[model samples]
Target: MLGFINGFLRRRQRERLRVAEFSSYWLEILKTNVPLFNRLHSADQEELRWRVQVFLAEKQFEGCGGLTITDEMTVTIAGHACLLLLHRETDFYPELYSILVYPSSFLVPVKRDFDDAPGIVHEGVDVLCGEAWPTGAIVLSWDEVCQAFSDDRDGTNVTLHEFAHLLDMEGGEADGTPILQDHEHYREWAKVFETEFTHLRRARRRGRLTVLDEYGAEHPAEFFAVATEAFFENSSVMKQQHPALYGELKGYYQQDPIMWLSRSDPVK
Candidate 1:
């Protein structure tokens, strides 16, 4: 009875949000800041707007480092984050409850324990553009967010990178593999990803330029995020250079950016 009541309430809330007014100003922000928005077909664009509406209503945004949250900031962030949900069953990033934005790159303190030497720990500080926490929070550099979306071909979006981590965590951990549609898919996923990940590491070590960022070589989790950035932003190059990897992502995302780009007016 409790589960049924919650389900009904959720449906009612989504119905209301779906019919609410969508501002023209928010559309303008997408046009100006998020280059990928212009490439989406009209139907996909509408679906994205609907999802963003629900997302904004559910998630909390907090400004940090003397920054003030604005309609532009939240809307733009929501727009990019929702792109990951297009054409998929989504819970609007179920584990994410808050977004904390900073004015620019911020420092995070870190502690590392040595494995070989007992009782030895090292503390350090690292600058980050974005981070997703297991505790239902995401920290981002606002300036980096804007800059990343400004160039859709760069294959380096802080918003997408961080949000991908949320999806990975939905199954209880960030293991570079997300829950797929079927149990059988895991075998193919593992095999293809391992091969491609090895290829990336080799390319990085040999100083060869590849479509995926070398940072992806850091871990399977990071590889998934970096591959996602490339899948959407650098679709054509990735499809050509890494056809198998592209196939895996294309199957997962269910949107062909190359096709979208082909039909849309040329991106300036």
Candidate 2:
């Protein structure tokens, strides 16, 4: 009984926080820093604002490598993250609690096996701009996030890529599948994704310039994340080049980013 009461109280507190009005400063940051914000319909923008407020209230942000966490930084990050949550009934990434930001690309340890000696292994470092752990946290480089905003058509947003992983992991694992509306949606998702993933791999082997990043050929999870980036950042090309895949992403995200592009101008 006590545990139930505590849970209820916490839920109530979070609801109150979500209802609270957002700050004007945060609004300015979205207006000035995120061009995507301008492309959203007024209703979607309002919804994004509420989602951002809830996200900022719930998640912790920390700076690394001599970077300082500022309102601008938090709002910018929150805004991009909330874009993924806009049309979905989400708990705002309930499993993710923290975001760690770096000034630029950071190094992480990776393991490799020796070809000469099967039993021997060594640790190497990989320079990365972002990573999304299954449940705990997301790490990002602020430089990459800023670059995404400046060059929106590049189909690369570290923030979107990481957050998409969070979505993929919502089902207790990150195996390229996320929570769907029903079993039918799941079947369709699996079918379309597998077909497209196979096609991408084949295209890469043949040295074809695929619409999605070749990095997606690495794994199914990576394909989902990379496709999400292309879906939002380079929707026109995605819609034209890969119609079926684009339809699947459109159905999942519930937003036609191509429409947003049309409203602004032809995406070159």
Candidate 3:
């Protein structure tokens, strides 16, 4: 009787968590906001909306610089950030405690914080974008962040970059590695990343045009960031040009964005 009672309590707790995670506020946000952007498939968009609802519930966001954080701000950030976890078995971002949002461009004083365990010399990233830290905070500028969803096609999204940083940190280290279900997955990840990484480096050197930009060659770390941008924006083009790389990304992200494109897509 005692053992049965313990099992019942555990099961009840899990059920409650599921209900809380997929709560009413989250469902409403998704129902309204997701259809605005046709970039995601109905399924992927639904997944993102659900994940964001759950993420906002779990994380803490502090509004700074006299900006009052509202429900819109919370939902916007959560929706995009949750896209990063749509395919993962676990949305393992518990290491992040707080999110700091500035109304516009904010200067980050330069400093180096090196992690000897990973031989990573963390340089203080400056300028007008976003930054994510392993087990640290993710920072965003709300002013620049809105462009990520603009109907006009641009090659950059600061939120996506920082969020990509969060995704990369999932392996408990940020050396361009994220969670993979198997050793076989790592072998493929390494090979495709190295080859495409070298291609981007060569293109940048020779002043030639390429799909994967020069920013990718900055480091293996930056490669992950740039690749993520390409993954969401120009997926079909990337797939056509780099079949093997596309295949790996499809597996890693667990979303085949190429299928999201339609015959009527004028940009394609």
Q: Stretches of candidate 1 above 4 Å error?
A: 1-3, 114-119, 264-268
lDDT string for model 3 (1-268, tens) is: 9978976875565345544545466555544443223456656655665566567656888877777787766777777677667768874375777788888877887767556646555667577557787766888888877666553134456676788878788776776777787887898899888998888888889998766767888888788887877776777677887888778877887877666666344220
Summing lDDT over every window of 10 consecutive residues in candidate 1, give the lowest-scoring window. 259-268
lDDT by residue for model 2 over 1-268, one digit each (tens)? 9978977886787678656888888898998767788889888988888888888878999999999999999999999999998888887898999999999999999999989989888989999999999758999999988888887788888899999999999987888888986778988899999999999999999999877999999899999999999999999999999898899988888899888976754221
lDDT of 1: 0.89
Please report the TM-score between candidate 3 and the true structure: 0.79
User: Number of the top candidate by lDDT?
Assistant: 1
Please report how far candidate 2 places residue 82 from its true position, in Å.
Answer: 0.6
Candidate 1 structure quality by residue, lDDT tens digits, 125-151? 999999999999999999999899878
What TM-score, to 2 decimals, does candidate 1 have?
0.95
Alpha carbon RMSD to native, model 2: 2.6
lDDT of each: 0.89, 0.88, 0.70
Give TM-scores for every candidate, taking all chains together and pairing residue i with residue i: 0.95, 0.93, 0.79
Which residue runs does candidate 2 get wrong by more than 4 Å? 1-3, 114-117, 265-268
